[model samples]
Target chain A: MLTSCTNAIILTVNGDEHMLVVEPNELLINVLRNELGLTGSKYGCGTGQCGACTVLIDGEPALACVTLAVACDGKEIVTIEGIARPDGGLHPIQEEFLGENAVQCGFCTPGMILMAGDLLKRNPHPTEPEIRHHIKGNICRCTGYNGIVRAIQHAAARMAEPAAADGPDLVKEAR
Target chain B: MKLESYVRPAGLEEALAVLAAPGPKALVFAGGTDLVPMMRKMRMNGTLLNGDSPRVILDLSKLDELCGIRKAGGMLEIGAATTMGVIAADPSVKKLVPVLAAAAASVGSPLVRNRATLGGNLVTASPSADTAPALLAAGAVVRLAGAEGGPRELPLSEFFVAYRKTALQPGEIVTHVLVPLAGRPVAGRFEKVGLRNADAISVVCAACEIELEGSTCRAARIGLGAVAAVPVRALAVEAALLGREITADVAAECARLVHEHISPIDDVRASAQYRGWVAEAVVARMITDTAREAGA
Candidate 1:
């Protein structure tokens, strides 16, 4: 049996730093939802099978459920709640996801948006297959996945427009 | 089910100190992709039975000693803690061992690949580990480091002993996987038959590597998974292909030999009979495809 240990850690979540005490066994999803009240990242499978708990750890897509809170110390975590602009504006990907009618039950939207954001940031212009491949982990039982794929593609096009007129400066401001 | 302590050792020695501390049982977690879920299930089962689960998790993700993908001394050395995603995208690794890269790519999904480490996959010793078949086909050597022995090397074929078990001794951990690239020009291919195209555990997976000389096979290796207690090299299949021109007839014989060699049991993923059939099919397809790629 492992000896029980709790640790105090500083977590940088969504540009805000929070000092919290966590048990070694506490998962990042629970810490994000219960401790900090950032419930935008949902717990779907709790086994990391579903990507509803996906968050950006240093701009990379990561499942928060399987990830231990203690392991994520000192990393920058960006949840769905953190993607909104300071002026109370929805991020471009969020705007596009809504515009493309990608929300079915909205349970998987946060993860889908984050995952698409990750893909778009890495590849400004991705083919349909690439977008589909990126979000394969994030399951959307509703909308038949066609709309989700279309939403990610649309988000990619909007994000790569090189104009801040219609869309927020997502590439610069978000990351 | 309570976790006792989470230690992120700065170096291998510090990590060994925690592992050899002589108190609570400690387990090494590289990415925690497989370990975390297994731990959760164990904790739940333990709570029901009033038993003890792993208490200490020695997080190895932060250790620089166990995290990299590079070529050194004419070998492609992948650190044990290197994530599957990085391995899949690494240019050098992809160029040297395309089959390993493909196997790494076929694992789970993007999110899982980002967190699943090569060492975690091997140490878990899952018969269906996607990377194992390819690494086994490539003739990779695993490097182990311990508090006592310092470091040692073992062929990947000898690393796995049984289901979910490895040859790792107490306080010893995998440090790097070395893929030797000194011999003949080799071409490889990896194939997986699963319930879905992506994010599904393998019903059967195969990795085939071939060395060719003007439409004749000089050497061949076949690794098959999910058909036995451990990932196995298909020696019978390799024998059928070596020193012979890879052809449709040879491929058919190799398939039959694959079925003869594997001893599969009926599991939730597939029936024993079905696994046997698919195992041969995957190995056959991979061999033919890899041979064709090499112009055999």
Candidate 2:
């Protein structure tokens, strides 16, 4: 019979590489939150339904709550913390979320922001329905999601025109 | 959940050897979307804790043999480990088997679909599996490899033995799903009635693939899900529509015959009566939509 054995895995998170020993059953959410001190990914429903524990695994959004850490060896992961600019500034999506009052309790903010970032990356100009469709996995109990949808639209507009002085003001028009 | 060991075999041969081992309960792990949640549930119920023997997880994500979509002869052979995201986005799948692509797209959200695999969806054997109905309607075949046998293929219709049970043997693992491509153009549609638009389990789902010459149905295959012990092909409905002209009345009559093939039970998602009603509605809509797409 196979016995319990700890496996050493290397995870590159937010462009930093770290080697850690994890159990076979250790989930990626626990490894990121508890072991690596990156708690941006929240553990909502341990099941795959709620996307609160979302993170980018190899450039694709995946639920970390159900992902085994050992299964992610040598994979590049980006968390909510990594969504910020390299210069320590908030991303456009984050800026729009704050500017649009998209956040209420902030429990689902990290996941929502990460999902928006992924959406904007894939589609620079997404319609309102596309934004809603892309972030369907994430659930926010506080905000009815109108603000979230508007914030994503504002971010898309801002990202499309980086040099425009009226980029941040697009949220007002969106509202 | 406590796992004794996890092994990511380097190749298919090594994976089969590990599965053939006499000791330890080995579970095939792919995508980990279903298995991880299932293990967590078992842990919550104290089932895994009470078990005396160790459990081994055989991870197949790294096996190259089980991870691609290719065309071989007349078949579109899709690797079992191919993710739903890939399947939904693949050009060949979208162009060839559109119903499968639509079904794959209607699975969980982008995050879930990125990690959830085609094999995991079918192997989990859930009655409401989004991809099962499309695959069954497409007349797909499952290829299995075991320690003893060289390799074997089974029709998707025969793969499911019972509720949450498959025909997989002790040492067998699903390697690929081969979908026979039709020589002629076929119109297909997949409909899934979930509680919400996204990330909701299906109350009733149906897939229809119809070959039409003008308004006459040359051939038809109908698969239904979430309204049976396992995903089932609506054989009676297919037979009824074989040579009939696909009109609204014909579609409605064929839909009414779907109840004879499905035995849905009341669960948290829906009641059996609701499923029956929804099944008829969805089946009728799918048939009508597919026939219309076929220019019937």
Candidate 3:
């Protein structure tokens, strides 16, 4: 029989590796929010229904609420805090969300942005239905999803262009 | 949940040994989509500590042997720990069993599918499980490995004994699901009726695989979910379609026979009468679509 013991797990979060000891029952969201203080990923619902606690594990969008911290040992995690430009600028998706007025209460914004980023990475040019379908797991009470859908489409269009062709200034001017 | 220990076994043998051990209660952990929520509910209800013994979560996610998909000798062998996202996106699965792939794609949502495993879905034994009907229609079998014996295989039809119950014995873990590939060309379709398009549990679901010779049905397999205690095969419906020239009228007639075989119950998502109607409609649509695709 196995005995109760704290497990030392290694997690590479946003390119930084942290070696920490955690209890077996500790959830990934708890460790991230409470231990690391990466509060960008919200805890809207403890259940997996709400995608508010979504984070990218090995480049796939997974629910952190249901994921145990021990199971994520030695895996690379990218929370909403990690989803920015290298020079401390907002990502295209984030900019588009702002430009499109997708953020209402902002509770669902982080997860929505992360999910939109993951979707664009997989499919650079997604149709409107595909974009809506991809982000179906995320729930937004205020926006009614119209602004979010528009923002994702705009992000897809912006991301499809060459790096030098479009600048963040254009998004700022539009907003 | 109050898990005493989280054991990530390095190998399948070690996992089996841990499960076969006498004292502590070990719950097999895969994609935590189902078990974690259930555990949390149990914890909330203060039922997690019913027994004095400590609880261990035997995580099988790290085992590479349980996380792949391959084709061997006319069977698509999917590892038990293979995520639904992988299965849904797999090219091999799409080509061989498109219905299964579609069903996988229709499960919960992208976030849930990224971690939910095929074996976990079967072991949870939910009657509304999306993949169960598709796998049933494809005539899949599960390979089980226990500590005592080497390994054994059981048909997917026999895997579920009742509602929320499976034939999985203690100390035994599902290794892989083997879906037989049809030698001849076949057309299969899967349909799910839920309150919403995504992340909604099926009110009623159906899958149909039809092999046609000219205009006559050579072989047919129909599987239904959420219309019974367990995901079931509509054997009577299948038998009715065999050797018959499938048309709109004939499909409608056979779809009505599904009501005779299934016994659905009223749940939160739908009423029993609504499920019965939806089941017939879905089965009819599946039959007609599959037959058309099979060049009927």
Candidate 4:
């Protein structure tokens, strides 16, 4: 249990920073799930073997299990919930994931989200094999990889289209 | 371990001073994915778990002493702290050191690789360590910083004498790894035998590097992992492959030499006989793969 008696932890999540006095040995996953209540990331294996605990550390996906809360001091951490805009608009990846029905067990979704975000950041247009290979580190037991792959493609197609609004929302809101 | 006290030193010198202090128990933290769990599990070699553990936990991740990759002379000096993603994505590494790049890509997966360090791979020194054979096959060198001051260099081949053993003295720490550039990385292949397509520990792995001119082999080096107490080169295989034409018959003959040099043990991942057999096949594959590089 982290107490006020110990050192204060400073976390910059979703472009917002928070300070807390956490246990010296608290895990980043725990800090996010418990203290910050940013529980989008799931904990599958406390050991680093499983990618279920992955989160973006400085814009790169990192295993949250082995990462200590104190280690993240002065570092930026982005969780799955943080992917959406401040106005509650989903990032294209998340929207595509929902549109493609990519979520299953919901356990590995956060890790997959982080990994997919990482892939698109590095390569906007990745082949199926490349996408598979990129997310190979992430394990989804519910395993909607086919849907997940489609979601990525769907997201890519949507992103490829100009964002000037297409079908329903544009005309109705224009009035 | 329930870290008793965590101290993020202002610099490397302060960290080392804390580490070097007599009886001031400490564990260096980098990626912590391994150390933290092992400590948390109470299986850690030193330091107490969640109890009396360390007066301070030194986070080496802050130390810039071990990061990045750069062109150095004819070889590429990959900073020990450099992430696996950097290695896989680097154009120079992909073009020149494809084996290393591939091995990097093949490590635990993207998320794990992004945090795992090559220095940690060598320092941890597990027989099933995925990156060891690749480093050995590259004929890379490790630089260690010790209590004595200036850093020392050791060929990766001689670094690991046995399972979980390294030449580092009590206070020595691995600072960097120098992987030779491609086309000159000794012409090697890192073939791993594991349970899954990815994230599985190696069952029996081998990396073979050979320098062949036309039909004749010039120099040869073979590093086999998860077969013995330590990762070792199959000397008999090396001798058999060198100064000879690369052929299936010769490769078959070289493959059979596995029993003569390797000392595999039966374990959960595989049986002794199976490990030896996999070693043979892995070696054979390496020879053929190197043979295809006639144009490389």
Candidate 5:
């Protein structure tokens, strides 16, 4: 969908700098999946309505499907593949999602986990309603959202531990 | 759409210059939440991507000149490029004009708010634009910077021309929005009804601001969205409320008058009759809520 030559962009994905050539119409989700082979972010609606392609841009949740790759020239982005320890230990949010049976088909997990991770980082002791409010964008067609909300609450409790005080940092590894 | 080039202008002047060029079908975008999807749909329809001429995108995300919220000279000045998330969460907005914050908070969701901009919301000019009614009720003024002349200011009410239209001219960009802080005590309320709790376009939304003096209405402003061609102010209702005591009977009259003022049409989200009824009910609730909050 581009007529001109590819433009150079230096994107810090999962704490690693990758200089790639992208087109003007290329979306962030496409760049993350095709160019970088990080397919953790799913492309559900291609529109912003669905949170299937949600990712973190500067520690805030953004819909990658609507986000242009050209606009994200020098920003730090985090995908679901990056939300784990270097030693292969699962992030607390990821572990809790499993324990709460939040994964039905597992399509919306990446966005849900990242959104919950960002929420816990901002509010270490968010109430149940607050947990539901944070993941409003990420939709789960299978679990009916009860399990997802429960998983976020469980993650908040786990991340509140003194050793895991830095909730988002636990998932943010230096690759 | 097949984009031939992308330009990231460093400043407002450079951006205006890029838009003035006549080679390709150039378009300026801030968040791209709305424009990107429209273009993608155009491409899917086989209309834009395979066209003969090229399409150019002027990315305005890096233009820091149009992104922030500040208070100066007794007004809240919001940069046009400021994201909805930032505006909704800003302490000053939350404290002074909570209705605007509520409207912004009710927008799509966190991800959508993170990327959606105030300028984009206005520029798109959807009849159901979430922030339009709130800004209109607050009496906002928009600042536009163009290529030829110095910046100009226009009241937010006059900025919208028609359905999906605005008063913006070619090569002009929305720079800032000025919202006057009321010197007197005021209470505001905002309400929206959607199909679902989140991520649903508004079926009907209403916002009201009132200034009270000993249980009598000193002044009032009312705005409604999705009931007309453009988000509109309820002049008849505002006129009826002024100088009248805030009461259930007065609110009923104002709510009835709302139906007389708006021209709604049946659409996918709602029926014209449903919008008319909801407009009345929502306005009545907002008026009563704001009156109670103002102790009137």
Candidate 6:
């Protein structure tokens, strides 16, 4: 009975390990927001298609709203809150987004920024079409996307500059 | 989101062992893209039968067994857990099975593709699914596995028995999809009409695979989605184009047959008449593009 009653979910968010006891009906988004106090992620549609709930699972951007909390045991997870360094320095993507003026009232900004970060991590210098293609699932109700596109392009340049210097060796394999 | 029980196994063997036990206690998971939304559906019919409080939540994330792509004998072998983003960007699939890549690239968005798996799409078995029509045209096959036995396979066309239905047994899960590789020498295209674009379900869609040999119509296969209860092949058009000379007249003939072959109904996204017209127009356009790609 002791072995049979084992229940544990291990999560490592932004290199931080978290152990949780989750309800069978709990979602990753709800757990992150309600339990762990990481509420930077938004819940727009409660559906997977909307990128509002996007988070990185095993270093890959995933929809957290639809993800079951129990499914993330001993796996790496990342949310909008984790994008910044502990010293209060912003990630290159965050700096680029602010510099390029990609935020507007910014309800969708958290998801947008994280999704862009995920895309740049995978492809440092994505084409215009590729940039659009990558963010297609993350919708923006305000600022009508000019700023988002600009932000993505700006981040891509910064990301690609490093990769260009180090070449393919600098490129981390996508999970 | 609250769950009663959650189980994460290091791999498939461990996960399957926990799932094999008999109880209303468990539900298996993947991208969670579709399942999470279904739980919150406002008007969508049929919720996941696992109930609100499953005793077992088996997380299969550690199973690397169901990821990646392979090519052999002119067939594209796609792992069940292979993300749509990976498939869309894979150069091999782009060059050989471009239709699949095109369909993959068109799915939801980059974030979705980063997590959405091809196996998840086919397993969900929505009649309007974007990739289904493309895979159907490519002569795709489905491979499945269970706790007890060896892997088994089935034709992708037959995998969808009906609307919101599948041929998968309760204990089994899909493992992969095999689609024939069509080189540049051939012609094919996929077109879908959705509510808006980017993450909308198809109101109507069509896919065609064709070949042109020396100005003569060598062969063709057509697949339609959301125009019926299950995605159906355009046998009428396929029959009409076989051995026929490439011409505007041939496209018109194929378009005519396309109308007769499909049975679309009025739904929230579109009317039956609009679906019929779009089906015809899409068939004609696909033929035009395919023949043009053939360089004649």
Best by lDDT: 3
DockQ (C-alpha based) per candidate is: 0.49, 0.53, 0.59, 0.45, 0.48, 0.42
Model 1 agreement with the true structure over B1-296: per-residue lDDT tens digits: 46677888888888887887787567788888887787787766643111335567888887898898887887889999999999999988788899999999999999999999999899888999999999989999999998886699999999989777789987788999999988724799989989887689999888989998888888888898999999999988888787888887788786789865688888888999999888877777777888899997
What TM-score fits each model?
A: 0.95, 0.94, 0.95, 0.90, 0.94, 0.86
Candidate number with greatest DockQ: 3
Q: Write the per-residue lDDT of candidate 5 for residues A55-154, one digit (tens) a residue.
A: 9998788999999887788899999988887777788888877777788898898998998988988999999888888888888888559988887887
lDDT-best of 3 and 5: 3
Tens-digit lDDT track of model 2 for A1-175: 1223678889999999999998888899999999999988999999988888999999888899999998898999999999776666677788788888898888789889888888888898999889999989998988559999988888888788867523444333223
What are the chain A TM-scores of the candidates, in order? 0.89, 0.89, 0.92, 0.86, 0.88, 0.84
Residue range A53-112, candidate 4, lDDT tens digits: 888989878888888888787889999888875666667777778877898878888888
User: Residue-wise lDDT of candidate 5 within B1-296, one digit each (tens)?
Assistant: 46677888888788888777677646778888888887786666534432423478877766888899998888899988899999999999999888789899999988899889999899889989999999998888999988887999999999989888889987788998889985633599989999899788999988989988889998888989999989999988999999989997789888788876689999898899999889998999889989999998
Q: For residues A86-170, what per-residue lDDT tens digits would candidate 3 score against the true structure?
A: 8787888888888888999998999999999998988999999999999989988785599999999988888888773257564
Runs of candidate 5 with Cα error greater than 4 angstroms are: A1-5, A164-175, B45-54
- C-alpha lDDT (0 to 100) for residue B163 of candidate 6: 77
State residue B239's C-alpha deviation in candidate 4, in Å: 1.6
**Docking model 6 quality class:** acceptable
lDDT of 1 at B97: 92
Cα lDDT listed for each candidate = 0.85, 0.87, 0.88, 0.76, 0.85, 0.75
RMSD to true structure for each model, in Å: 3.4, 3.0, 2.3, 4.0, 3.9, 5.4
For model 3, report DockQ. 0.59
* Candidate 4 regions with alpha-carbon error over 4 angstroms: A1-6, A164-175, B9-12, B43-55, B73-75, B180-186
Q: Could you give candidate 6's per-residue lDDT for residues A12-97 as a string of tens digits?
A: 97787888877655778998999889888887777766678888888877788877776666788889999875665666667666
iRMS values for every prediction: 4.1, 3.4, 2.7, 4.7, 4.4, 3.8
For candidate 3, write residues B1-296 as lDDT tens digits.
36677888878999999989998668888999987777776665534332323478899986899999998878889999999999999998898899989999999989999999999999888899999999999999999999997899999999999878788887888999999875633699999999988789999988989988898998898999999999999998999998999999999999999987799999889999999999999999899999999888
- DockQ of candidate 1 against the true complex: 0.49
